[model samples]
Target: MCDECNQYFAKKIEKRVLEMPYFRDVRHRNFIESKKRRIPVSKGIIGGAVDLKKRKDFGTEVIVNSPDIFQKILNGEVKHMIIPVNDQPIEDNKLISRFIAKIAIESAAQTFSSKKGWNNFIINTPEFKELRYYARFGDKLDMWNYSQRRIYNETDRFLNPKVSDGPYEVLHEQNLVFLRDRELYFVLVLFGIEYVISITNPKIDGYKSWLIENNNKCPIIEKNERDTIKGERYF
Candidate 1:
């Protein structure tokens, strides 16, 4: 990847994705690592003002509407605090589908590039033409149907004895679920939310049916399949 194209994807595509509330809240509340170019979700409305930041000891800590309120809680001057919020992020299907398509293709290319003639195979494959176009130019092509669901809450405190806090949260996990006669599905779990897309076709019914038969288990943590390279990932 040239520096120009790298910057283009980061600034043009990935930036928009990380800014989405689905991502923003996950990164902020869970304090996931985003490296240097990461944008911190600073301000939020929890029925009032809030400042998100790291803690002195470890993990995340939020400063509430005012210093006094925060200090009051610390000093035991305030007994209880309640924050009620309508926290659902608006779904941008087009933007997210583009991302899924982009990563799915890239991961597949990376996996197969080492094999002789595979790169050319991907470049010239007629099946992937529309998906490639959709990834690079969203909405200019017809929208693709994808499925999304939350497996767990973003701020869920998971038990982890290794960390400073007894709890830890998931940052991200992904896998390319490729099987014979099945639509190539990319399963990306970001901060406990699962986003699945079929790269081979626009329909998501294939994944839904697969899930039902598999007892609704997430593909990432499922029993590792011996074969992973029918389509994508570090196969």
Candidate 2:
């Protein structure tokens, strides 16, 4: 990577990290602090499923607003759930939701694996392949859109270069691809839970236990309030 390319990638990463909803959140800051001090932080997992029913209550589990679920996840609510996809039905909504969820999970796993220095963590697993299939192919098993194709191509080029030339450019393109895919995955997951599923509530205790068991492998952050900047919450 040339100096200019390295600088560009660094800037892009910094900008994206700053743009994250949790960027200035207290809990996230604390997590970073704890990591720096070599203190162990308890990790939790946040997952979503499609539910089609609308109920008055969610029992002991608090019902978080659907739009705020992602923020809640960022805040570290290790176990969170969103209700049915939406008020109206759409064709193949269930299948779409499942596909989006898979993509989000896979992308998250990839991010974590890269950060934790695990090159082969979930990327090469059967589960990963299954999820990738869903992401790469829609309900009809057709190819993904051009954006997705571009991401895949960029990823390939970044990971395997024919020669050592344009290293920085390849790396930059890879990061851009990741950012685009991550955004798309989140959008799909949110849409799926908002409209398609039939369940009314989530099993919090079960999710927590699962998180505890998988903490070593997948650490989760705790939820915190989003910081206000100039009277507007970072979305």
Report the number of clashing residue pairs per model. Answer: 0, 22
Q: What is the C-alpha lDDT profile of model 1 across 110-200, one tens digit per residue?
A: 7788999987877788757777777777757777877787665555545434443444446677778775376678888775568888878
Q: Measured by TM-score, how close is model 2 to the native structure?
A: 0.24
Every candidate's lDDT: 0.66, 0.31
Off by over 4 Å in 2: 1-95, 113-119, 138-235
lDDT of 1 at 224: 38
User: What local lDDT score does residue 156 receive in model 1, on the 0 to 100 scale?
Assistant: 51
Model 2 lDDT at residue 70: 58
Candidate 2 C-alpha lDDT tens digits along 34-77: 32342122222245422222222422233334556557667776
Candidate 1's TM-score:
0.70
